[model samples]
Target: MNDKKEIRNILLLVFVIIIVGALIIAKFYGNNQKERYNISVIAGEAHAERWVVLQQGLEKAGNDYNAQINFYTVVNGKDAREQKDLINRELEKKVDAIIVCAVDSQEIQEVLQKSERRTPVILIETDLKPGHLYSQVSPDNYEMGYHLGEEFVRQQEGKETTAGILIDNDKIAAQQERLKGFEEALASAKNITIKWRASDYQSNERVDNIIGMDCVGTQNATEISKVNNEKISIYGFGNAEANIYYMDKGIIKALVVPNDFNMGYLSVQNAVQAVEKDMVYKNTIVEYIVVTGDTLHNEENQRIIFPLVQ
Candidate 1:
């Protein structure tokens, strides 16, 4: 009888140990299974028209991907030294990765090299010089330009039409690609001539000057078939969506739309994914809309695409 009691006590002790061990293992597994990442976005400016929608999209992406986004704004992207210093500060934070909308395409490479030494970078809403950057998530600027170019060809079927670009006039990825795509799309058309000289290259002053240039189309409803600036069709890039609503009651035939909110949100989410998985994205092209008369009139349409935010 004494031996049997001792055996029963030992069995109870073993059962308790097994249950305790299973509980500990379950706790550790649950903690490790959850994935999280940290990300940063370097926006050119806080008040930029496009930045608003980009912010909304970024928020949406964050909710979807389970990540966090932090934004760093510069007074102006053109100030290279200041921009570099800003990047250095972000690097110190040891973010998993960074997303950039560079102010100057040329000088940004230096910043990229410095940050990339410690973490990966994803370029968003713009392009980067091709060698070492992680990935680019942006709208197809050139394709959007091509769509605009096609608008000129269709409208002027038989008439001679001229087109111009309002751009920064730099080697920036977005600017160069857009200019290239616009020209290619219009390459075969003889009646439509793209202005060899871009009258208003990208400058804050130039962007500010376009009160009613009809960068896309003659937005005035006064005359449905004719343009106010009949001879010239202008293409504005940044915050181009504003032209949709701001112009008098008419439709602009061609404009480029950026999915800013999505870009903002995805940039953060992708950076987090890169950190958690130790991986990076390649050739991730965000969506861009080619707005013509049919699409631009609806404010809701504009909101759905890029959400005229700034």
Candidate 2:
């Protein structure tokens, strides 16, 4: 009876030792696991289809990298104060990284200054003065515009052509740069002249009468083209769903489509890397595709105009 009791006690003691060892191993493993990162994306406009697609890409990257994303947008993308408020809110949230398309580069300066030391800030689609942020992910706006101008010159076929230009009034640096590049490239062709320039498409009286019109944004381009029933050749930026619909109907002659999907995906990926991996993030320039109705059916252009996800 004594021997049996001693044996039972020894067995119980071994079992307790095994249980304690298992708990310690589990705790160590849990502690060593990587923490998921949180990235925030602040776009100029939330409702626009382009930004919507960008959000899709951001989400995709978040999923791919095991990170979470908080996306914010201004009610009116052109309103600097609205964007500034959103930035401040994100800063308070203590996000790991911030990606923004600034409404007004200068207006966001002070807000960015507040985030400089705490978070990794990245610029997308639009650029600002570079000191406060980590890096920028955007297309070469000048190159995109220059390509559109080249297309315009080709369409004119050396005849004197009067073109109307509708520029965004929001003072987005990218838009202004696009307009500048287009103007400079078109100037080289003496046969093409910009006869009218206006911030509002409706305000440009010659929109319908001109040989062609260079629009800076997709919304205005689609609107003017539809309202005029394709009366003039329309060339512009953006690859929104409506823009694609208009292009299919032969309303928009050409579109300078940026790789917005890649922009979003890369921005998030880089942001997460910047935080967790101690990786160096730099300016990433996504390329643009000039899609026309003729080339829209092509496989590569189709991917740009009608993305699979967004």
Candidate 3:
């Protein structure tokens, strides 16, 4: 009778151990099947060449981070308003986080705030004016602008004494910063003087505005050069088209190139990182590349780029 009782107790202990072990295995399996997080990236427009490189980088990041990332693109040449509306729709989808390449920084900020009212937002490529919200994921365009200023001074070291600024429109932040930075650098150079103009008009009008003056509008550099045959140096975003125009016409002496390819790549990389677990991102700034004589000589070397047509 004693032996039988002991055997029964051993059997009960084994049964209890098996039950607990099975429960632990089941819990581990359940947790492994759960999703981590979903990330969304909004490109202001679909047509720009730079966004193409950015999108690839974004996808790669998603794959590496083990997160679900959807890139939403709108029609090219659409208004910033449309991009904002589309962003709102994505926000409603309840993504874990968002990354935006704003069409118009100021206009886009208004939309970002609404989305952030629900989740964290990271602004990439472009940034809102001070005080709007979120971390900036781009370079110091203003500083790039100042660098433009200093670059002009260095370029004109022993040459002409008169120069000017061509801004794209009063609207773009990068153009404005380039203009400002260029002027500040020229300020200390006694040999050169700068003028400011808008690129809204044609070559004839541009020449009329700055024929005797140095021109600096971040817009239509290629066209602006055709108008201003005077010995003028341009300080604005570099475009391959514009470079060819200037090279053929002998108009632009130097230009500030925005590495759009890299910007696109970095912006998307940031979006991917922000959405991933145990990942982090530091905002990037617009870096400067100077394109001059030999470098801008050939189409192959020029960097005003768009994605390949599929």
Candidate 4:
């Protein structure tokens, strides 16, 4: 009887020791693994060209930092109501953070402000009217416009030139800023006559130069110039593959390409920092490049022009 009791006690002690050892190993691994975060991105439009590059950046950063990105967009770029609804839905779903491209700066300001109370909010491209956004990632629209204007000035070489400017009619702040900066650059140039027109307008006015203020505008101007067979010099902003193709074919004379991939990657990176380290809000103005036919294939620009995800 004594021998049987001793044997049972020994077996029970061994089982407890094995169970405790298993739990200690499990705890060590659990502590070593970093917690993955859920991040949501709300874009102005679905399948927009700019967003394509930006999405690549976002995905790359998400992979590097162990984040799950939930990307959402409205069918219409200017649909503020839909954007508001989407923001509400994401908030209810309890996403860790939100990165938004405001369709109407004013219309969505209140919603964004409210959402910020619950989670960290970062703006991409367009910012709010009151400028209350704690953080934003975008290119300097004014600088880009000014740079394109400078390129035009260089090409014209102070010769008298007739030019038409094409810009989006959405009246977003970014577009407006681009227009303002371009106009300011041209303000001191006495040899150019400016004809301002909305992107939707189709006019037969033959001009020596055509300028577009954004990706869609650039593509539209390029198409119009091609279809009309107008002997015109084209300059605009964007890094769409189509724009690059046009540049290669000499259809686009000058292109202002914003680093949208950086925009995407940095915005998410900032959001993650805000969540984990309680980082303060900051505005990160991404870089841009002015590429001409002659300089398009340079090694520095090629990386941005043809981004490869590793």
Candidate 5:
């Protein structure tokens, strides 16, 4: 009887040990499966509000897909060389995929050509020339600009109109496309004249009748209006806090806002697909909406404008 009891105790101990070992193995395998992807996202400007939302979207998608994401930001104002170095570093690290918001599409062409064949390359908010990239995710800049132009014409209401356009930079593809569309939209309007168009945002410059082409331009127009105690009819791109503040005060007339959260989310989703499934990604264009002071508070508009919180 004593021998039999001792043997039973030994058997119980063996059973416990086996169960624990099996649990450990399962946990290890689950963790390994969870970390199957390593996606790298590189942005042109780190401090920008739009980029912040983009990063939020990326994090959300990463969590949903059980993938790891490493994000890099370009400081010191959109330096192409800095972006190129970051891309090369990620390439050397052998990251599963790379997402880039190129500062100068032309300048980064060589590095992309070298690294794209090895790893999937995704472009966000910008595009390179010759157009044969792995993928591109951005808003329809031309359509946004054309919509703003249409609003400007509506504001004029058949009256002779004179306006100045404050462009962000003509060299940027997004900005160039926007400007082209705006011009094309206004081509038939003989009564409206563009008095001055420039990239610089001068606080001392006239803002009485101005069409700001971007966030910086809109801010400059607002500051000029504040200094001069004048109400300027400003229309531009972006949904920054300051832009909304000016809109509330009735200083800014209209805005063309991009769905940046979707841009970021889709970029990463496509990147993961490219790496894991060998998927081919085409141009993924994010949608935009026009907002004015009267329509800013609408529920649908608020959702797009404040995507991170939602």
Candidate 6:
């Protein structure tokens, strides 16, 4: 009788243990299978060629992290008002997070700040004015500009040269920083002087060199150089297809290419992290590379300039 009672108690304990273990395993698996997060991205330019690589990076991250990305762009070019309106619309829908390449830092600062209180916000390419509420994932604009300036100075054979700067929008905070760094770099070399700074090309103005502060500015300068059959040396930022074509044709002297793929991938990855893990976001500086006509076809540079089709 005693042996039978002992055996019954042991079986009862084993059954309870099995049931508890099953419950714990189910709970753990359920936690691991989190629902996919929804993230929204608003780029400064809707049709910029550089976005191709960036969008790929974003999509890769989204796939890796189980996120659904909704990309938005300004239909009427780079307009701060349009960006604000988009932000409001996203907020109304209550997205999990927002990633924006601001058109005008000042114009969208307040709206972004308010939006951050309710949703996670991330900045790309440029950051807002000081004391911003969100984090940025971009190349060091000032440093990039400075390096481009240094490259320009290196190209000089100790001859006096006049350079004109073309920028898409002076209001863009990234452009402003790049412009500052370029100017400061030029300041050290008295031989090179900035003849004029304009948003659009000046047909009447002539200069030995033209420096584009953004991809649009670069493409504009390249097109102007090709059309006018001018002998001006063009140097600017971006790895756009147009830029590459011009560089191959020797119309563009050099380019400062940013890791746009990393920018896109990290932005999405960071956004997902901010939502799931409550991670404290901070500035994540991506890398950049300088490509000249001589080095454009090199294996390493090609990897940076051209995105791999996966």
Scored by lDDT, the top model is 6
Better of 4 and 6 by lDDT: 6
C-alpha RMSD of each candidate structure in angstroms: 6.3, 2.9, 7.1, 2.3, 3.3, 3.7
lDDT of candidate 4 over 33-119, digit per residue (tens): 878989999988677777788899999999998999999999987788999999889888888888888878776677766654557
Top model number, TM-score: 4
What are the runs in model 3 whose C-alpha is more than 4 Å off?
1-39, 44-46, 66-78, 129-133, 161-164, 190-195, 203-219, 224-235, 238-255, 258-262, 276-288, 294-310
The alpha-carbon root-mean-square deviation between model 6 and the true structure, to one decimal in Å, is 3.7
- The residue pairs that clash in candidate 2, if any, are none
The lDDT, on a scale of 0 to 1, for candidate 4 is 0.83
lDDT of 5: 0.78
Whole-model Cα lDDT per candidate?
0.59, 0.75, 0.55, 0.83, 0.78, 0.86
Give the distance in Å from residue 186's predicted Cα in candidate 1 to where it truly belongs: 2.7
lDDT of 2 by residue, 1-310 (tens): 9999999999999999999999999999999876788887887765767676677788889888888888888888679999888878887888788888887876776677755455777888665656535678888887888888887777778887677777664467777777777877887788776777776766555643232222236567567766776677677878777777877887777788888888999898778877765546678889779888899888887776557532
TM-score of each: 0.72, 0.88, 0.63, 0.91, 0.85, 0.88
The residue-by-residue lDDT of candidate 6 on 17-64, one tens digit each, is: 999999999999998896898999998777888788889889989899
Q: How accurate is candidate 1 locally (lDDT)?
A: 0.59
Q: Model 1: how far is 252 from its true place, Å?
A: 2.3
Model 4, clash count? 0
Report how far residue 233 has shifted in candidate 5, in Å: 1.5
